[model samples]
Target chain A: MTQPAIELDGVGKRYWKIQERSLLRSLVRFGPPNKTELWALRDANLLVEPGETIGIVGRNGAGKSTLLRLLAGVSRPTTGTVTTRGRIAPLLSVGVGFHQEMTGRENIYVNGMLLGFGKSRIDTLFDEIVEFADLADFIDTPVKFYSSGMYMRLGFSVAMHVEPDVLLVDEVLAVGDIGFRIRSLDRMREMHRSGTAVVFVSHWLQAVQLLCPRAVCMHRGQIVFDGPTEGALARHHELLTSDADSAEYARGTVRVENRQLLKLDGSPAGTVQQDSAMIYRVELHFDESVESPQVLFQVYAEDGTFVYQMQTPLGESWRTLSAGAIATLDVTFLPRFGGGGTFRNVVVVTSIDTSVTYVRDDGLAYFVEPRIGAAGLSDLEAKIAIDGVDRTESRPMRFGGTWAAVEGA
Target chain B: MNNRSLLISLAQKEFRVRYKRAWLGVIWSIALPIFQSAVMVFIFSRVGRFGSGSSFNYAAFVLAGMVPWLYLSASVASSTTSIVDASDITVKIAFPRAILPLVSPVANLFTLAISVLILFIALPIVGASVGPRFLFVLPAAVLLCAFTATLGLALGALYVYFRDVKFMVQAVLLVWIYITPIVYPPSALKGAAPWLDFNPLTGIVGLFQRAVGAPVPSVRALLVSVATTLVLGVVAIRAHHRHDRLFVDLL
Candidate 1:
């Protein structure tokens, strides 16, 4: 396993929230820093073997950046130890630290050196880098004249070419055009296949699913779940939907045990034909008597793009439940729009007053397959009619071979 | 690559960027100091009693002193803020933090070398002789760069923690030149404050002035400069070694 390419043991990082910044105050700051301590990360532990790819998913400020920084050796852990075996390259940001006035050619050398490559090494890799970034003619031009995508491309190329043993990528892949984005991911996969330990951090769950066999979910500076990618993601969603008292109400008041997105025919359906009716069912049991619970459903496309959401009104008021009662609620809808890709259904059962959520069963992966020739978010079939004549495809016939018609067409 | 190459690349970027955008190219880096020295020589020559003496070619004296002093002031000012200024880069990626402040001094060395070439070419024209003493500028230049880097390193590291250091360095550099006997000579401070010899820049400026045969630098001043350089150099290198990985936290 190559002795854990990266390992963290009881790692913690403490930062001071200084109230004031002055030379005089700092010189005499012997009395406890005149500030409060913020532990961005605490007692965190991780071990990544060579050739392993792991995904880290977390909300903003969940210490993800802090964790990457420590692993990159950019920041030292305040309490414990962080150790790595080989050259560590941080794709923490896209082309970070690029000097604006320097040429693309020059910035590459500078950035490469910072990533632990020598001038000769960079020189050898120079042609490949320039070609990879697709900036052959413009490599000598100062980067200030380059577009943001060019900058990102050049940066990604240099970092990838370094062949580091440990790669820490943090949310920087979300930019540039889709073609380059896919290429970058492919290059990362190539590196991973060659024995580099990859720590991938992104909010895109689909990306996690595509890249990682195992994923770690972080919350409030600690690893909340670490196991199969699906389980970690499910736990992350559970964290997102419920508060601290979730378990209390989830088990005692009303508990949603299972949920499913099924075709109206009652067969399991992950990918169904567009415009077909499907049923989202949430099966729950009441441990204690409760009245008028609100149920919510949300649908999101494969890319984590929000699709549609619905909630029972403030009054499902007439509805009531007693202890030991079990019920199944079905939401049937024809997904007329929001098609073209895999989707998922999330069901949340909350208290009537909206104070607490009892359960959120979110791992129902559903797919609204792209209808054969359909494209975009939905299949909005449009047939243009002019003067009561269907002329959407009449351009060639109406214009025929007329010279003036060619320009108009 | 090794740290040495990284340092070289960083310095190369700094050197190239400074002169690349100007219409005059690197010529401006050489010309601006000569212009300043020309004016200082003209004024100092007329007011000989305030300078070293009528016997000395004050023009050569000012050029030698001005080159290092100008480099020091600019380098130190930039170093004071280098760490804080690069917080964005520092926070995102990890590298040796000490190198950030050192980059400015190393970059300035390119311009300083060009200015020194101009200084030698201008010396004979200003009635100063080119003799065996000219070789001394080699050691003196090294000393000047080393001193600036160390002072800057210490200041840059401190600046990250104490935001006031940047302004304080500027305020000090403003009054520092006049007190260091750059335009005049060390003899000018004989009666007013002999302890002025203890100021580190006193010996540094004294060395450059001596390179042009302006005045003999006092032993105390040289000792003080070396002493201060050692102390500050230690502080700078040690701070970076201990805090290089931790600086990102504060940033």
Candidate 2:
């Protein structure tokens, strides 16, 4: 077996949260600066072979960016070692080190050199970079004149042309237009095929799922789960929901608990098929008396786009509840998401007139499999006919077992 | 690809971007020093009178001093804040952080070269005899840049933690020229001339003055300048090596 392309051996990073950064205060203070230690990452050990892509999923401050910084060699781990076999290109952000006053051509050469490419090498790949960026006309124009998308495209184009052995991507794919995104994705896929090791970090679970087969889920500076992408995402959601639960309990008014997505038979639903009916259920415990509580349901795609929202009828009085009352709320709906992505179900409890919000439950998330050969935001369930002959699958693709199993399919 | 080439390209970019939009372009680089030198020569020649009985031409001596002084002040000021100014790049990319501090000195070499050329051209008009001693300006320029770059590296690293270094540097530069024996000769200080040998820039500015037929700086002053550069160089290099990857954390 060849060597792993990237390796992290028992890595940990400790950051000192300095209370006061003033030089005079630091000088006058006793032993050390007033600081608390924060371990951004702890005991992380990972190895990726050549041609492998791994996604990282985590909530904010969960050590995801810290890990990427280590991988990029931008920061040193306080403990252990991080090793990469060959050239590493960090696409942490597009347009890093790009001078606004410099022409596009000049900026490309400078950015390429900063990434460790020689001027002669940049010259050889200059045409290809500009063409890929689709900025042939603006190559001579100063970057300050280019649109933000154009700047990002040029930066991405230069980075892709480097063809690094190990690529570290952190949410840079979210930039640029759809056409450019697609092209950049294709470029990444090409890099993946050519035996490059990739570590991708993003909040967009759908993009992570599409790009990486394997993933690591981070929580509170620890790797809670490292497995297939589906399992990692599931673990990530579990951590998020649990964190939200503790925060909600601290609010002290109405507490939302036991949020779940359930099947018709009351079993917990892991993955729902397109157009399949599932119920979102939650328990609301009120600390004070409430009048005519209403429920609002919202669905969000994995990328945080609001997919659907519905609420209780306006100006309608259900029933008033006395203090210390516990109420269970359930709403049933079909998962009609196209392109088969993970989605979240959120329920908000409020007054009948919507004047006041009592409690908002941390969302429960589930997966939806698309109709066969269907891709988009909504599953239109369209039929195609050729010469009066209908050509559409009579039954939608069946997604069985838990969401993790769907990764193999 | 290598740090050297990266430094050269970055410096080139820095040099070009400075005057990219300005209508006068690089002439500003040549013009600023000449104008400053002209004003200094006019005022000091009348009021200061430090150079009245001097053997060498006073205009040439002042211009010679201004060449390195302008480069030193400009390079040091910019390079001291270089790392902080490039926080966007430093926080993301991985490179030797020391390079950021060194870039300004290298970039200002263009202006330095122009000032030196103008000094040489004006020497003849100012009645100073140009001789083979003029070649001393080459080593003088090199040593001047080395000293400026090392100081910049050290200050740039410190600036990441204490922002007061920025204002301190500016304040120091304002008062630095008066003490460096630039407008006046060291002999003009009378018995206090020996004390002037302690300033690090005394030796550097002395070389420029020497190029235009001023007396050679004291051995003690040259030793002090070289020693300061060596000590600062060691401190700067070690600081960067230890804090290179860690600088991004603070940034």
- For this target, which candidate reaches the highest DockQ against the unseen true structure? 2
RMSD of each: 10.2, 3.4
- The per-residue C-alpha lDDT of model 2 at residue A184 equals 87
iRMSD for every model: 1.2, 1.0
Candidate 2: list runs displaced more than 4 Å: A30-32, A247-255, A271-275, A286-292, A300-306, A313-325, A339-343, A350-357, A365-377, A383-409
Cα lDDT of model 1 by residue, B1-251, tens digit: 38877877788878778888899987887788778878777787677556554456777888898988878987898888888888767886678888889889988888888888888898888779988787778878878888999999999888888788888888898898777787777666568656778788888887887888866787888889888999998888888889888777767
List runs of model 1 lying over 4 Å from the truth.
A27-33, A243-306, A309-409, B46-49, B52-54
Clashes of each: 3, 0
Q: Tell me what fraction of the real C-alpha contacts between chains A and B each candidate also makes.
A: 0.81, 0.64
Candidate 2, residue B225: Cα displacement in angstroms equals: 1.1
Tens-digit per-residue lDDT, A220-298, candidate 1: 8888888876667766655654432244435546776656667888995544556779887777788877788888888
| Backbone clashes in model 2 | 0
Pairs in steric clash, model 1: A116-B1, A117-B1, A118-B1
Task: Assess candidate 1 and give its lDDT.
Answer: 0.78
